[model samples]
Target: MKIKQLGERALIQRIAGLLSGGSDIVVGAGDDDCAVLDTGGDDHLLVTTDMLHRKTDFPEQMTARQIGWMSVAVNLSDLASKGASPIGIVMAMGIPPDTEVEFIEEVVKGMDECASRYGTHIIGGDTDAHDELTIVGTALGKVKKGHLIRRSGARVGDLVCVTGHPGTAGAALFALDKKIPVSQDILKALFEPVPRIYEGMALAGTGSVTSMMDISDGLALSLHDMSMAGSVGFRIYESRLPVLPDVKRLLKKQELHEAAVFTGGDFELLFTVAPDKIEKARKACPLTVIGEAVEKGVFIERAGRVEELKARGYEHFRQQGQ
Candidate 1:
């Protein structure tokens, strides 16, 4: 059977099952946004890594600078979801020998700019020669004891919330794929995403956030993740979903809904909070209450009816075969 038959998440679970860790590991694989390590101090260490490839990840419209910025931004998003502060990042680049030196310089400059914006820096990294341009970035951060948020802590009746807007990156990609003209703002949203670092920290500080995860794989897939991790279900409201004006105007309602559910690269955070703590979350961060956690099955209410939410998003291995 082909690898796609197993899918990306399944393959990751298979690999995670083979790995073992000691007591120093606070959280293991397939559990949270980032791996937690006990530092033998008041603060715990958080680590996450992300990779970007030219042919598969980067779009033709994005420049070298945007690509480099994105390489760091994605990893930082993981740290943000965990309520960790910026420590530093190390990057490794695989480049084609034919690439110009100026191109590399611009990419590095972009990486530096993004890291500085988020109060972090790229201390060091390694480079290797390859046929395609590939960037791998590892981000390190710290969170206080008893303050780390996990995806497994969500409880029944917790309000499902999301920061800023969802489906912008997905809408941008949809325009690109269709050869349609898009605004610069939309392109920027897709090419250079801003990780919600401050918002995440603020929400975590409120002590009301239960389960949280970054929405890199689309809203539907993210909800599924939280559901699986917490062993609970979600009931998302269609009326509460924050759809952008451009998306609503450009695509039909059905197309827009599909894009919001299945489009990836948005980098927003999906979190849960108890009903009593909803006011705390609202004051601490800018978020919209999209739904609530249920007792059993995941469903979405639209037009006064509810239905099962199918998991359909950007799966690397699954897309290869399609």
Candidate 2:
């Protein structure tokens, strides 16, 4: 079957099935945010990579610096979800021949600033000529073995939580599409997302967090991912979601709810915490309890009616409106 018909997630599962994993590989492909490797030390090594293209990933409104920052931010977000402290980043860029040198310089500067903000640096990278501006970044990180969090440890009664406000990025995208005037703060949510590295580490240290992942692909899709990983279901309440005030004003109630649920690119942390340890988790990081884990089925309760939360987000390679 064609890849589009198979879908991105299924294709990943197929690819993962063909690969072989070793003993030192704590976490392998298609399972979690980063691949964990036991380095025979107190900490495990975390590795993740992400690819972004100009047309698909970078919006036209983004500056050269934002593009560079996003390239590294996406990779770091993955490491953050695993409670890993970033060591360094290696970036590979595919640039068009006609691109200006100054623009490339700004891109590099942005990458450097972002990495440095998170206490890391761009150690090495490669560049090549391509038809479009393409960037691929690989981030390396380490986390104490006892403090490491993954997407599979969620238990059936754990509380579902998320950090920061949801739907801000989606709202920003909506505003940009509609040509509505929006503040730079809202626009920055999409242009320069802040990876929750500090919060992730704090949560990991609390030992209250059960499962964790970054919400780059919208809350619905991320929750579905956690559900699959932990073999549990989630029933989140719409009223409990912490949405930005700007988003509420930008869209009507229905639109706001939909944006919060389905829109992607937030890059916030979505995690589950043990019920008894909820206070500890809260003390470690600012989070809102949106729901609780259930035995089976992912559903959302809105207006007193519960509906299935569809697994849909910013999927690549699949045709739109499929």
- The lDDT per prediction is 0.88, 0.93
Residue lDDT tens for model 1, 279-320: 999998889999999997788898999989888787777862
Provide the lowest-lDDT 10-residue window in model 2: 313-322
Candidate 2 per-residue C-alpha lDDT over 255-309 given as tens digits, one digit per residue, 9 for 90 to 100: 7876798888898999999899999998998999999999988999999999998
Off by more than 4 A, model 2: 320-322
The TM-scores, one per candidate, come to 0.97, 0.98
Query: How many Å off is the CA of 129 in candidate 2?
Result: 0.6
Measured with C-alpha atoms, the lDDT of residue 11 in candidate 2 is 91
